[model samples]
Target: MTPSNQRCSVAIIGGGAAGITAAAVLRKRAPQLSVTIVEPSSTHDYQPAWTLVGAGEYDVATTRRRLKAVLPAGVSLIQQRAHSFEPTSNRVQLEDGSILEYEQLIVAAGLQTNWQLIDGLVDTLGKNGVCSNYSYDTAPYTWECVQGMQNGRALFTQPPMPIKCPGAPQKILYMAADHFKRKGRKVELGFCNAGPAIFGVPFYAKALMQVVKHYGIATHFGYNLVAVNGPGKEAVFETTVDGMKIRHIEKFDMLHVTPPQSAPDFIKNSPLADAAGFVAVNKHSLQSTLFPNVFALGDCAGTANSKTAAAVRAQAPIMVSNLLALRMGSALSAQYDGYASCPLTTSVGKIILAEFGYDGVVMPSFAADPRKPARRYWHLKKRFLPWLYWNQMLMGNTGPDWHAKREYPDTLPSISP
Candidate 1:
């Protein structure tokens, strides 16, 4: 078969946290190797701040930056969406019909937000008091809706499983409640969660329960939002019980909706994906099952971990190592034992830093007590994490041992292993 162009040492298929981080680590470790990033977006988002913005902590200007500024200089940056992958030739087909070849491929394209999954959710997001922190445009609307309403039913709905920052849906809820409490206008706060429990992790869930009671938030488990009548200010939810239920109408003064999410369409339809549409990779190494040259990181990888950017910080180094190893024609040894994290922002001053790996409770960073909510955790999330994410992680100036060393468990192996 004839090829279209010269094959690259590595073609990273994304410019977000995972992809860029991998590129930075690769260049730092092996400067001689050439890297090209194929990304569609010119602007990158610091999504962790979106929750803070929805809570009136930050404005839109603070959450975004030019992608060119963040990416490592001199690397070939192809600003295009990867439309399809040809693992046989180690090539990716861009949306513009251009093809890129890579000795190694890192699919850190991340998850897709499915606002269209819910009927009428997209049509009336910015208007009709429908707001979500998932988007930059809708985040301020959340604050706007929160501000305008004094004392009426304010419904916050968590769509379905596996959205980024699973705790984020409720985090905004608590902050909004805290806002009303401060103003002496504690409106009706209802948490319509799709999950069966308050939170997947129990340790933090216990702390969450205390806060829920403190703020007097009505927690409804197993209730999923099915439809939104935004013009009428009404939301329809379906109950997970045996009822095969229809919509239960609930009028709202303000509605904050976290939409359901899934893997990107291309990955889901490709052989690279699992049943859930996530890229099927070794849970430890993040290399694809079908192709050794192919790897995935971040939310798109099918690992048994909470999909969080904090986890991406840890996985980026592992992916880089394994990708480099594959390029050197060696067996991978680095493993990423599903180390995902979520910063459960209980309030403006408090946070439960939920850092755990697979098989429940793997927090080597939190040597002290990972269970209890600490002011230190709050400080780290509110003050330090953003700095660490931007100045360190994105800029490739992170902790010295971030991707170079393993600190979690002695018995476990690296994800690339």
Candidate 2:
């Protein structure tokens, strides 16, 4: 069974931001340890750019690179999809029926887009005015729809809880409104969200409401999209509060759907997953609760953090440090506070960067007031974030905290919504 390749100290299951960063950190900390990353796709996508792409600001190719180009130089690459896991044998089962055993494991196979969950959505998406920002191919379709329409209900839906980038639903809505405003063709915009609040954090919620007011976006909280009649240009939304009385059917010229998302099915069904579905790991260490040798990060883990690339940068080193701590027989001292960032793009040039930690705590890294919308934060998001993401974070150079030394003003002022 063991015919070709040599065993590695760590086997990474996905080559996305979390998987790649984990590999980079592991190699940096333990140069002698063998590491390999198994990923199926050759194209590496910077998913944060999806927003800009939909806004007609960036193209799809601008956010992508060859997968091999970003991987650590010395690490072996297995360009294959993991079909299943055999944790009992410490082996990963690939689609080609090959076996790769390892000393430790890290699974970062990010969220899956369940486009088929809504009726007729699968056949109609990326065509016929039914588009989504979640897909790389369909992001431009959103812009095309925006450019093509001036009237009619432009419906944007946020699926149920636990989707990646929770604020993404609202972000797209604001951007779309801005596009219409700039074109001088005002369109009726409706936000149908599954949650009751615009945002999890109250400080940012206040700021978002102002943008909503300026753009005249109608909010229908507690509304979840259940069906899509794309050919007929209609979307069905069910009310969470009043299931029977509030069922509403509306026709739309454009629909921007943030599809329902979840941890990869294989990882969720395995022993590593907890009851609710997600790799069961200690929130602080990012290590498997049952098996100490296994670790998980990104959208796949049960860490009580918002899933974003910004969070992955904060999580990678902690997971790496803990894994190395195990190899060196040292007590694990590093901890992750569920730090995650969401750059809420309210306009083409402005962003309300919401940085928070465990339990939705607003942990701003910059000293500027959290309530005020400043150009500096937007500049950081536009100018510095990509550099920090590709050069510093993915390169395994982000130091711990990157936030610990920051001091935001508490006395400047506070805004309540």
Candidate 3:
């Protein structure tokens, strides 16, 4: 059915974490506002739990819910893909050629996973021991590959940066390593990362290096997975040294790939996008640089913060507050400090919760040493976070402001050279 040319006070471009949370907040704080979300999918996913799903620790079924069930009351739902944005005219063109007009727009369409970028990946994914935790369907196959492996090489590949949850590629690796250790499986593990470090934050990267050392996992830096010959169980990686590109092929019994990601096609081609193709918004205000009536958050926002649910949690309230202020003709007081958290699963029962703000400043909520892995954090990741996401965040509760002002020791120990 073609969508009617209905105008809304606020129109969200995606029904993912950012869009839903923002709509929920607007419904609670400003119930008079007519909010509409344009999303193609019928189900909303709690994507953070997919890491555990791939580790065989969490049920994949629990991570998803029907989109209509989770949406806040009185908000309109447009179950269609956004084809293009006409920012100058304050209108969005849907895939069905229907136009949606909004006084204010929120671009939270999230990033796109380019699976076909890797040669033969689409043909062999979920079979021939080629799997990935990136998709809900493929995630379960990763666990299957891990469980079936007795020996030989197990390889995990991480694409270049800006992918949602950068720590995800290695999180499964650690879980698989811990699983093998418990089951007395002698699988040789290797991590192939296109980036130069295990993590973006130096403080956590140092700690993660120790975890990699503990697992006896081979670390291949600067190696980018370019092709996957799944039938032959061989993976190809390209790298550059001395300005010359080189391709390296390695045989593997099992391979987990994290595909390259970018903003959705409609977003990339829109005038609101930056040079990097993400929604061009202020790093702090989240207001579109070109259009003040527009805002963005989550993976689609052109911010330096790590793309995670935690970032969306922080960004939603700030964006909502600022948007409301703009509507009220008041100064935009709420500012997002780029706070994002990454709970790195180093083992089955331990997690190194890496929390940071702009410019990689350590921002720990708890007083405990933020660098150490702990069992409590594991429980938080496995249990509390999911509950908070479904009940609190989606329910329009932002909780307390504990992360912004929490202080940490200045003289914390550093990694030795």
Candidate 3: residue 202 lDDT (0-100): 84
Clashes of each: 10, 0, 0
lDDT of 3 by residue, 181-216 (tens): 989999999999999999998867878888898889
When sorted by lDDT, best at the front, the candidate numbers are: 3, 2, 1
Q: Model 2's lDDT to the true fold?
A: 0.83
Which candidate should be chosen as best, given lDDT against the real structure? 3
lDDT tens readout by residue for model 2, 128-240: 78888897888989889888887878999998878888988887788789788888986999999888888887767767877788888899888889888888998988884
| Clash pairs, model 2 backbone | none
Q: If candidate 1 were superposed on the true structure by all CA atoms, what would the RMSD be? A: 5.5
| Candidate RMSDs in order | 5.5, 2.6, 2.1
Candidate No. with top TM-score: 3
Off by over 4 Å in 2: 1-6, 242-246, 399-401, 404-417
lDDT by residue (tens digit), candidate 1, 221-334: 888998898889889888855767756888888889999999999999887888999888999988998888889998888887888887888888888888888878888899
